[model samples]
Structures are given as structure tokens and as C-alpha cells.
Target: MLELEFTAEDMARTRFAISPLWEVVAGLRVLLGADEQGLHRRWAEPVRARIAAAKLDLTPLAALVPPPSPSVPGFICPPPTTPWPSLEVELTALRRTPRELLRALSPHARPGVDAILADPDRRLGELADLIEAYWEIAMAPYWPRIRTLLESDILYRARRFAEGGTRLLFDDLDPQLGWDDGTLQIAHRYVRGVHTLAGRGLILVPSAFVWPRVFSTTDPADLPVLRYPPRGIGTLWETRPSPASPALAGVLGRSRARLLTELAAPATTTDLARRTGLTPGGTSQHLTALRASGLVTAHRAGRVVLYARTRVAEELLNGAGA
Candidate 1:
């Protein structure tokens, strides 16, 4: 044994930052006690089974996952795989070796791996790697096909972590970046450590239908703006950018423009659904898609996910329908 030494404080500081998939992976890791050699065999079995059962193509999911990020400091890897799978296998393997492979590649991701391994709460710990790997795989070849689901998973997990009193800052610099509770807990611990670190707050921006009300009336330059008009048909965003600015009168047709017009009043998803004659799920799906695109935001009030048009939505709503 290397006689590993870590303090209670240090141990507590090690937070798991990842997607929900990591929770499952961490759970399985504990369920199977093998070192590196047996990990892939153990995890792949269940994951492959689930995918097979669901009839989901493994390829499209592979492309959207982001690549393994640079390693974090003070991190260490568990034993690594023997003959590591090719990049292709790493990207699309039914199981989690790709994420494990990712942790093996970087120190930051590794410490969380080790923390989960060391944690007594076997079930929750396992998910750490599963989430991390999920994100890593998003950048592989077939990502476009499942990007919506991936984005939803990322948002769902991120909200969970932030709600848990973790700092949970997305790599705002990287729009594609996401962090789960594991990462948020780690970030929280880090933030608490420094006596002088500044506290930050979240900026709640609405999604869909930019309107004048969403902007600060104090400054004209601060007015809500959009790169283009809405252009998709499904609950998911599938439209192309419009050639005109939000000021353009012909951004979208009449009905779609009406959707923006109604969003000036913040309302619950259920309320929006009732008013718009859309199914609850349909409304949520659209709101979630819009949230992902930075056009709208969903807020949790009591039990409802309220949807509001963001500044960009407000901007586009201004003249497009006028």
C-alpha cells in the first residue's frame, strides 16, 4: 500500500462534479471492487444493457460529449486500464470506460474518482464519474443527434448542485461547459476555504420572445438583443438564424411572433401551456430547449417551472411582431 494520507478536511473538500450518469457509474464502481483491470467489464455490461433496452443508437450520443478537460490540481488516478480502447471505442462504448479513461487522463477529474471510491456512501458516489464521462463523450462523432437530451441532462444536474448550496459556476467562458453537484460541492468547498473570496449571484434571464420589459429601462444600449429570429418546429430548437436583427419586421411569421408577445408576463409552465393550447410536456420541452439556447429561462417556484422570455427574447419581440 502507498500509505495514502488525506485529512478529514481534505477529504471533505474533495467534491464530485459531474452529471447524473456519474452517480450510476460511481454506484457500479462500488458494487464492483476490482481495480482498473475489471472496471470496464463491470460497467459496460449494465450500460450496454440499458442502451439495448432503450433502443438508442450509441453513435449519435458519442459525438456530442465534450472531450476530457485539462486535469485539475491535487488529483490522483486510480489504476488505469490495460490496453486502453481506441478513441472510437472510448467515444461510443456502451459502458463508462471512456469517462474513466477521462479521469485517468487528468488529475482534477481523478480526485473525484478517488473520492467516490473512498466514500462510504456507495450509491451517490458512483454517479460522479458517470456524469463526468457523459459530458466527455458529448464531443464525440454523433453528438448532434442527441444534443438536446444532453443539454437537458446538463441543466438538470447543474440546477440540482446549485440548489444544494454549492457554488456551481458553469464555465461561463465555455458555453458548452456544465458542472454537477459533485463539482459544485468541490467548488463550494474551495470557495469556503479562502477567507476573502467574493460571493457571487446568479443572473436570471428569461428565454424566448425578447421584449422591452425584460431589459433595464435605464440604458438604451442595454436593450435586449437577438442574433436572429426563432426558426424551429419541434419542442427542440431546430431552426436556422434569420438574416435580420431583432429590429427587422419580418423576423418570424404572425403566430410565432404572438408567442413572444405573450411572454412579457412571467408565468408557470402550466399556465403557459393552458394559455397557448400546448401540452404541458410540449411547453416544458420548448422552454427547456429555449433555456439551453440562452433565449429563455425556467425558474422553479414552489412546484412549477416558470418560463419567462429572456432579454434576447424581449429584443426580438419588440419590433418583429410590431
Candidate 2:
């Protein structure tokens, strides 16, 4: 078990961020056979075909994932300075990482990575360009959907914070995580230690590609970050039917019944509002009424509560609106 000791200051400064670069790396892993159950197969198969068609050389980037070691060096994957920095911004930052730091970390990396570390001035730029190419093919096409899911997780986590401070916020973060007193316990096979966070707070980053596992930055020199799978990942690639027929609108009223059909898949209030063409306040009010009637259920996934149709509602839909 790896434990992080949070000082009073660390808790105060802790924040959340979404990293596109991390997704680039994690998505590459899916193509590299890391996605055991094909959880990402729906997305990965096509991405793999695209990489093949483009003949993208991902060797240098792959060196940073699992080959050089289970632990990726922080120089290439530094914590983002903003909540949602662009991929270009992060690549720029990666390109600018001090050569001295690169020199310090270049001991035993594979040939692909060692080349970049050996010549940070020239080779690192090439590697950054390579990452950009990989991102365009592998990540950019699916970014909007990915970003929405990550954003929903952040919004939900903020609510958890208000409801019960950090305790509630960390409660459903991951099965491998635990919180008590002022420490966070992480169960990992290789990363085991007790580190103190003197002042630099932790960065909680939600990822769509890193499902079924979590990663933490244990290096004291770099900013600490906890990267975990966001909620709703299993259904991230699934498509929902276009707004259903208005058959059920009669019993539940046009608005409430529309929401009931929209719950064909779990969705956030904001998402439902936008899709259903209802105002946010109107969506919330309708959802509350539906929940009270046992026609809809609110499920807590990470920081956000996703509303889905209940069995009773499912029956009602098929009988009248199916």
C-alpha cells in the first residue's frame, strides 16, 4: 500500500485537471494490447487501423508508457498548469522542459526514449512533433466526447466536496483508494511508500483511457498527481437513440416524459438539458419529479450523479412508448 501524507496546506491547494496528453499515452496503450477485455475496443480498433494507414511510428511514445518501466518519467508528462490546457500547450511545455532535468532522467531508457533524452535540444523537438502527429490521428478526432465525460466527473466531484469536504470527494474515486485522517492510501503492486506532501497539493486528473487502474506521481520533485478512470467510461463509446417518439409524453406530460425516454442511457443534467432542448433548471425540476415517482433513478458515478430509467419506467416505456 502506498500512502500519501497530506499536510493541512496540501488539502487546501489540491485541485483537478484534464490532460489530453495523458489520453494520448493511455490510448496508445489500448492499441498496444493493454486493453485486456477490449473495453476500449470499439474506439481502439479504428484508431489502430488509422495508425496503420498513416504508418505512424509510435515507438518513441510507447517507451514512455510501459516499456522503459511501469513508472513513466515526469519530464515528458508533467502536471498541467491549468484545469484544461490544450494539447499544443502541453506539447510546448514538454518541449521546453529543462535539458538538465532530461539529462538527470536519461539513465536506462530504451533506444527510442534514450535518443530524445540524449539530445534534448534537437531530438526532443522531434519527439514532441511525433507526439503531436500521434495525437492528431489517435486523440483529436474523439476529443469532444472525451472532454465532456471528464468535465462531468469534475462537476460531480465539486458537489461531493460541498456535501462532505474531501472525505466525500474521495469516497468513490477508485476502489484502490482510501482516505482517513489526513492520509490517502493507494493499493498498488509496485509503487509502495509513505510520502509527505509538505505544501505542493495533489492534482486529481480523471482519464477515459486509464480504466481498471490508477496512477499516482510519487516523485517529490514533480507536482503530485492522481490519475484515475472517470465514471461512465464503460458507456463512453455507446451511442444513444435520437430523441425518442413522443408516445409516453401523454402520461408524464411532454417535458417529464421526454426526459424519461432520454434516460435510455445515463446522463448528467447539463447533457440532458442540451439534448432535450430544456433549460437546465427545467431539466433538474423534471428529474426530481421523475425520481420521486420512481420512474427514474439517480446513480452516483464518481463526482456526478447520472440519471437512468428504472425497471418500472422501462416497463412503462415498452407498454406505452416502446
Candidate 3:
């Protein structure tokens, strides 16, 4: 059990963010041991084939992202934030990682650590280069789809936060997590202890890749980061849509019908556009029509507007199915 004691100020300061760099790093975990990350097997197989075909030297990466162990350093997977931080920005942050933090990593990682310490600029550059190459081979192609899933999760959580405040947000994050009396507890197989937030607050990051478990930054000195699997990850690899009912299509037209069915979960106009291969403006137009028809409702979460099927729309879909 990991207990994170929080103060009123800490609660107020907590924020949610999405990290592209962290996703790339977390995705590599699948490559390290595909069997262990069975949830992503469909995605991992092709990426594995590409890595093998390219003959990419993943030695550095393999060393960097080792199996879950208490010895592994938290600095490597720094807390991620919104606006999708660039690789360079994350790399710079990594370069600034305190030397004491590196000691916490696996003993096998000492050589890489020593190399970085010997010549910080050159070694860090090499590390960044490896990360870039790995991303190009494994993640860059599927990032847009991955980004949409992550954004949708954040939007959903934001609504939860607004509706019931922090307790609802944390409680719904994962079964392993709970909040009681200003203390957040996490059930972890390896870690057990009580940590005070000390006014630094926490950063909640929703990840599409880190499934089956929740990960937290090890160093308490750093701003605490909690990376957990987002809801609806089971559908991330589902590319083809369930065929829209002919009658529904006839009433709303094929495009509109398809959009309505896809809103089984809340989604932004951009998310719908990507999933349906429609232009953003075109998707927005269709959503407006659906909203006007009382088939869907839209809620603004931050700068993005999320659309969900109204009760009438759900009944319409169920009736069509029947």
C-alpha cells in the first residue's frame, strides 16, 4: 500500500496532462517483453517486426527501460504534461536529471549512467538520438490514433473532476487507487509506504499504453506523477466500426449514422474526424445536426467539445440492433 498524504493546497495544485514522449517510452515496454504486455500484442507484433527489419540497435533503449524493479530510476520516465511535449523538451529535462537519481536505477545501467556523467552533452545527445530512432520505427505511425485515445480519456476524467471533484476523479482512475481523509492510497505489489505531498502536489497522466498497472515516479523530491491506464483501452486497436444499421443510415445518412454509433463514449470533433476519416469541419457540422436533432449532446471540456449520445440516441441504437 502506497499512501500519499495531501494538504488542501496540494489538492488544489494537482493537474492532469498528456505526454507524447512518455507514451513513446511506455510503448517500448511492449517491445521489451511482448508476452508480458499481452494487451498490446496486435500493436506490438508489427512494431517488433519493423524494429527487427530495420536492425535498429535498441541496446540503449533495452538498458533504459528494464523490467519493473525497485532499482529502476524514476528520472528516465519523467512526469508528462499536456500540449504534447516535444522529444527535445523531454530530453532536455532528462539531461537535467540529478545524478543521485541515476543511482536508483538498475546496477546494469551504471555504464550508461557513467557515460552520461563523463560527458553530459554528448552522452545525452546519443540517448536522445536513440529515442528518436526508436520512435520513428515503433510509435510515430500510430501516434495520432494513440493521441486521440489519450485525449478522450483526459476529457472524460475532466468531466468527472468537474461533476464530483477530486474524489470522483481519483476513485474512477483505477480500482487499485482510493482516497480517504486527504490521503491517496495505491496498491502496488512492490512498493509500500506513506509519502507526504509536502505541498508539491501531484500530476495525473492518463496513458493509453501503461495498462494492467499504475506507475508512479520513485523520487519523492520530484513532483509526484501517477501514470495509469485510461478507460476504453480495450478498444484502442479496434479499427473497423460495427456496421451501421441500414434503417439508421437511411434516416440520418451514412456519415451521420456512423458518427452517432462511434459516440458510444464521449469524443471530440477531432477524435470523430480521425476515426471516421472526415474533415474536422465536416465532423463538426454533423455533430451540430445531431445535437439539434436531440440525438446527441455536447459538453465543452476545456478547449475541446465532447459529444455523447443522448438517451434518445441510445434507444435508437438499441432499437436498431433489435
Give the alpha carbon lDDT tens digit for every residue of 192-295 in model 3.
Answer: 89998888888888887778778886465577888899889998776445778999999999999999888765677988999999999999999999999988
Model 1, position 304: C-alpha lDDT score: 35
TM-score of candidate 2 relative to the true fold: 0.74
The C-alpha lDDT values of all candidates are: 0.34, 0.80, 0.76
After TM-score superposition, the amount by which residue 33's alpha carbon in candidate 2 deviates from its true location, in angstroms, is 1.5
RMSD, every candidate, angstroms: 19.3, 11.1, 9.6
Which candidate number maximizes lDDT? 2
* lDDT string, candidate 2, 20-109, tens digits: 888887787778877887898877776676677678777777776763256567777789899989989998988888867766774454
| TM-score, structure 1 vs. true | 0.23
Q: Predict model 1's lDDT versus the native.
A: 0.34
**Per-prediction TM-score to the true structure, in the order listed:** 0.23, 0.74, 0.71
Task: Using TM-score, give the best candidate's number.
Answer: 2
TM-score of 3: 0.71
lDDT of 3 at 300: 41
